[model samples]
Target: MPRSLKNPKKAKRKNKGGAKKGEASSSSSNGIPSIPAKVWQPGVDALEEGEELQCDPSAYNSLHAFHIGWPCLSFDIVRDSLGFVRTEFPHTTYCVTGTQANSAAANSIGIFKISNISGKRRELVPTKTSNADTDMDSESSDSDDDEEAVNDGPKAPVFQVRKVFHQGCVNRIRAMTQRPHICATWGDTGHVQIWDFSSHLNALAESETNISKDATTVSNQTPLVKFTGHKDEGYAIDWSPLVPGRLVSGDCMNAIHLWEPASDSTWNVDNKPFVGHTKSVEDLQWSPTEQSVFASSSVDKTIAIWDTRLGKSPATSIKAHDADVNVISWNRLASPMFASGSDDGTFSVRDLRMLKEGDAVVAHFTYHKRAITSIEWSPHEASTLAVSSDDHQLTIWDLSLERDEEEEAEFKAKTQEEVHAPTDLPPQLLFVHQGQKDLKELHWHTQIPGMLISTAADGFNILMPSNIESNLPANTAAA
Candidate 1:
């Protein structure tokens, strides 16, 4: 089951079994008092010696947790042809993950086809004083029999996985945006290998429970191309979204290699490497619109903008953070905007146009107390992004939000007794998700409007928080 998160306005209480004074608790049809939901701020809230956190099923639209045999340090959501802009219930998704095994020979890459994701869809109820539209008259006329027919309990989610034996402990794995089955892997052996998992993907999409076990056999698993050009092992790699088959891989030795498609199953990597960063390139992202333009973040504490046509040097570079930069995400919807996270737990959003003119960054936050592990912009929302840190928290942010004094005063007056939150928290911080241990990577499902998948040492969590609003049809029923 997926863990629950408290609403931001809800007070953090040690004992949530009973509602406090001034809070109203309603009884169910069986006359049992309902427990009010509460937020538990990590580090700030302490649990009783015998008490532990528990999942609140009502707080989520959908939540599921599962683990593979081994822990995955890095993973990418593999794009599938199931559907686009999927907003209905019972969602399915595909992804590729690289595992860190006890021995190099035991490591493998996993391609999973997870399905039957079912859950209650939430509907926002408007307050009496709110100016939102209403349909109480029409809703009252609806027959109770019609509602009962739609109330079947959610079904358990199912998954089918295909394993491919890797030569070494896979440091990172990424599926091509244009060709998801053709993935690239950065191995600890200081080599980058391209794999064609089309056969495995085809089998998973076509079959139900009878997927071929031979797909996991070592003899049948082999890379389409293995380039042993980088002097040292690294994790930085990305495929161009604008150009199919174009790739860039950066190494710990401060070298970046460019790969161009020589044929369907092969790539020709340039002998000379891009040499701008003085330290390890921590992450790389190709421009969403421009084929040759890309951005890189490094341990040198700087962000460099490079254009392949311009040469080996960076076209523009800036001291982005005070510490080593760890990851970056180029916004696909907003081409000029990008976000970067650093080793110091701070993440900032930047505008490429402003950077070129030497203007200040758009927004910066230091909310995470530990180093940031992964950060990515939502594929569907231009102003929204998700971030994960070593502190074992994943936070969702909407860049467009700002402190509204009038709204804040109204909200405080309306729910003064039931609501509480630190004044120091940024208004842009929309939601905070916890319960995962040693969070390493997170990705928003491009097909599902508000779905998210996060991988940690504890395993994987697939959740869709009810609080995060999305662009869904107005007639959709709420749970």
Candidate 2:
């Protein structure tokens, strides 16, 4: 049975301030902080002496309660004040090349807002006044009369679809952080389509009703802007978080295209794509700190860091995995730190500041039993991350803590004694989420702390820590 992380065991203590052989020292001669060894185990919660605990197989179900069947290949959560998520699913059974022989149908994008129970139950009750012989008797009477006529009934929670657009088999969907109403999607057609719902938003404001419940499916409407440049199908697309209207996309043919909005309401595509990978470019991520800097992972088993203003050659490249690199995520809070998951069922973290030519990986985890499909760094917690794999599992990790030097030595000594033990566990494994089938992608909510949303072949799930308060809104901090 998998171990439960609701309560963990405390690890024994060890000494500090010493470096072992082949280990990087705390302070290097070059005045740079040497990258520490990544063998630390998961932190255990302290328990009383001689206390025993029982395990429950159903405990994992509490981590998430909401699940809906929506077969989607890729989805993105809007970073607006209101929590809205957009998911895109292939319209056909299989997504094929857009050639005339295999004319696969378009996909459907569904926009949804998670329901907020607390906001619905909240009633604005007017306070009672004690003034009977006030100077402004008419004003006081009007206020009292208004209060008497007010209704205090609780409203129903809002769970409705905002909109749905039927486009091509979108391999990737990304909502603009700066403009949450505007989103972009691209797929096998080698074309990127930009969709803007600013008019629909205005209609909702004027009507004061959610047309989302009636779910509008737009098929005939054309995209606000469309740009085509890739030779083959596009797989990865990301709008720059720092730069407005700037976009980057990667395709199956080892090509990465840059798109910028021109004054004529059309987008200007770069004459040349960022070409270096020998295989298909699987994923792309822009650095949270640097506007011009981005990273791309490929089937060639490497991840390349690129500067938009520089030449086509990568600024730095590293052999990231044994198999194809499926996903790459830049740490939102830490500069120069990024994580990659691969088809080898392993994930590694790399620090650009401490990177050397031969060894760029600072830490490695090999817990997932199958190939990792997606990886995301938490926006709320810098050291927290989430990974999804082909083995029908989603795991959360916390890498903020480090063990002391003496503790490290003791762990090594014990490992030498029990060489046959299962040593594949990651030190920072915090929570393991199961029960989903064919999991593809997972993401942390940008506005809500500790809330996560995942998409799979069977359905989509809205999950959180079991201890999260039920009354919290989709965008509010849980108690």
Candidate 3:
């Protein structure tokens, strides 16, 4: 009754290429070439129909997706004092931010407001298979039919454009946390401009017409304050989260300036700029708990923490990485705790309380295969963080988990086995986001608990945790 006896099959001989005798022959029987069918190789465990795969890092369930046609270099989420979360994207026709006339003429920032509607929900339907017919007449008819079908389907999520701000390709935008109506932007012109949108918002509330039809131009409206101190294009800017009307900006010339608003609608820049880094300052972030404390990362492969009250010299300086440091974020809940992401595809968390001259990092994460472009800590959760990499992935990590000794040992062994394999997802990882191409920016929604907004070269996405449902209304506009 043995299974081998029942089959009674002869052992198959292998070919020179190691293929079985009958599986893939060297030649065809009809004098034609034999093309071997691709064999499916299982890289991980297979899943059954309707079953979900449980991994160490939980996956993000997409809630809303939007395509904005133009590539986005940077973006920010503005939460007004009224607790309304608005998304903004700076779109440019050019890939580089240059001072040429063409770059200025093609730059515009898109501002969108997300509102929840009642009794309406939109679901993603699978894309339909195209017809095999290649006839021009048939293709034309099919295209027309497809358009008609889409128009007849349920409404899509509505992203109402509140307004558009026309300017040179803005490299960075930071909305003041204390004064939500005020925002600061800088780009190729080496000038920092502060804009107040209170009047624009008021006009929109009073008018029933679409604001995009009569968009405002930056040239027409006067900025609240403008400062031109950088000798070259400014790429980094940040408004103090705890202080009103205080800002700091960094330029390509390796210069950092602090600005404070004056009474005559002008900004007063520090006579002397912070000047320790030998390379360009990549990012700047003010401490959430300390108003006068801030940190800056640079292409010099170092991170320096500065106290605004002090002149020139950074209070604390550390050689953070072997490569350029691209982004730094302060932990909102824990004072003295911050994280830095570098061009070497690694990020580390450090505690300022224990930082010394050498090896101040508390933990190192090397999961991203490409340079880290942006990093942010959750405002609501103490240990949660989000990072975007050039590899086109947005990952969320929960740093609260404590791994056992055995798991730690196995993780180290696997890390050496596969140098290029994604860094082992510590139990701390919560989600890995995909679908967006050339992802550049990510931020947590201030009002929504588990909502995240991301902008990439092709489009933007509004992501939600797997357990949460979509908050969009059913009657919203479709993409």
Candidate 4:
């Protein structure tokens, strides 16, 4: 059976409204036909009258969305000391996001502590087609509509947030693995600022209310270290996982700077920048196991592997994509495997061992129809990945999946209905989550298995799909 099928008896619900019957006989109040598309694409398919996206409660382990007043261009999941490998529900997680406010003075770094993420798991009623299928369709529609109406209102999770005044629009934000309160921000003013928000985090933890106004006013909002060495602003930055406090920042001018810890809270960024890519460096990822090694994607349509001890040049470079490579995610569990997303709405996985033998790319996919915005590998599942694109879709994929003809045939026979999917849709495609507008970036919670937090123009979405399995035992719970 495919990884997408959690239970053979309960098939995945593709569309909320019953599949289109035929040409519409009459229009509905919403100025659309009464029928909804079988498979809706964001830009391609239009919704029929009275057609709205209805969430299947059974399809989600936990789903919640919230807004922070401003749209963040980038955000990172702050690893908390709240025990690793969390499996139980009502999880708590910390995060930091940089805002692209209308005015530079209005921009601030937002730190959030979200909790009580209870599951929305429900058992779906099996649909039975009888009386020429029309009677069954109406019954299904009424049942789903009632469920959606009950869940339509905002179900905001408990959260505490703090704001630190930033000098300019924050292009990207990253939190250190060992010390999550220590965060790095790439500002539009061409400066990278390192801040220690230990006070803010401490106050938040102590606070009892959902909003932490005391914590918001407590921090000095001063960066421990500020480096203006980069001539131009950039979005690419990453902290080395192997070495604590080791950081790297890449710029639009094709310059990458390495930062070493000078003291406990300060960094000594090398004046000399690492030069290799001809165009802007789009993203950076440090090797999870190798202390001195890292990888970079660039607007030059290539991916380069670099080492800090190997001078200013890249160790190896590959023409990894047809268009500008926007993002890259190095697999933490499987160090040899990494993935890259491009401007042309495509992403591919590569293996370092195969790259040395001239066969770098292991699996390439083009399911997204717009520019790939962000991509990341699951910390728990080495073969699993999550990608966001300009197409307004956040897709989760399991690369371990392959087409199973026998399973498909058996599923159709047992369910009495074929699963609705395009012929070209890969079996590896596990889930497609929509509804967020202009999705910017996404990250998997390192401590919480199957949990994903994404930011976009609208706000933030914290979700864990029901179908994705976690290896962590149920006894382990979040602190």
Q: Give the TM-score of candidate 1.
A: 0.83
lDDT of each: 0.75, 0.58, 0.59, 0.76
Question: Model 4, stretches more than 4 Å misplaced?
Answer: 1-37, 120-155, 212-220, 412-418, 477-479
Best by lDDT: 4
Query: Which segments of model 3 are wrong by more than 4 Å?
Result: 1-62, 81-102, 117-154, 162-165, 203-219, 403-424, 467-479
Residues 78-145, candidate 1: write the lDDT tens digits: 98887767777667888998777677777788888777766656554312322112111111011121
Report the candidate with higher TM-score, 1 versus 3.
1
Q: Alpha-carbon error at 471 in model 3, in Å?
A: 19
Residues 1-479, model 4: lDDT tens digits: 00010111211223322223223434454466444324455655676653455443444566666555567888999888778778765578888887777777767888878766656432232244332211111111111212221224322456678888988788899999988889999998999999998887887777656763233452346799999999999999999898899999999999999999988887899999999999999999999989999999999999999988889999999999999999999999899999999999999999998887885899999889888989999988989999998777899999999999898777667756555555667899988787666677999988888889887676677778777878678677554
For 1-479, candidate 2 gives per-residue lDDT tens digits of: 11011111112111110111112333355576544222222122222343222211112111222221224667787655333321111000101011011123423555554332211111122122222211111111111212211133222223334444444455678877787667778755677778775555444434423333223554355678777667787667788889877888888889998888674246788869998899999899988889899999999999998998888989988888899999989997886679999997899988888666565677799888788888998876777889998877788888865545576567557544322222445557766665556678888876555567776654455555432222334344322
TM-score of each: 0.83, 0.67, 0.69, 0.85
Q: Where in model 2 is the C-alpha error above 4 Å?
A: 1-70, 82-106, 117-157, 201-216, 263-265, 402-425, 467-479
Candidate 2, after superposition: displacement of residue 234 in Å? 2.2
Q: Model 3: per-residue lDDT, tens digit, 1-479?
A: 00001111112211111101121222344555534222111223233343222111112222344433245567677664333422221111101111111346555555544332111111222122222211011011111212211223322233334434446666777777766667788866678888776665454334433223124343355678777778887667888878788889998788999988675346788858998888988899988888788889998999988998887879988999889999899998797778999887799999888776456678899888788888988866777889988776788887877757687567557544322223444667666665455567788876545567776654556665552233434233222
User: Which residue pairs clash in candidate 2?
Assistant: 42-427
Rank order by TM-score, top first? 4, 1, 3, 2
Backbone clash count, each prediction separately: 0, 1, 5, 1
Ten residues in sequence with the least summed lDDT for candidate 1: 134-143
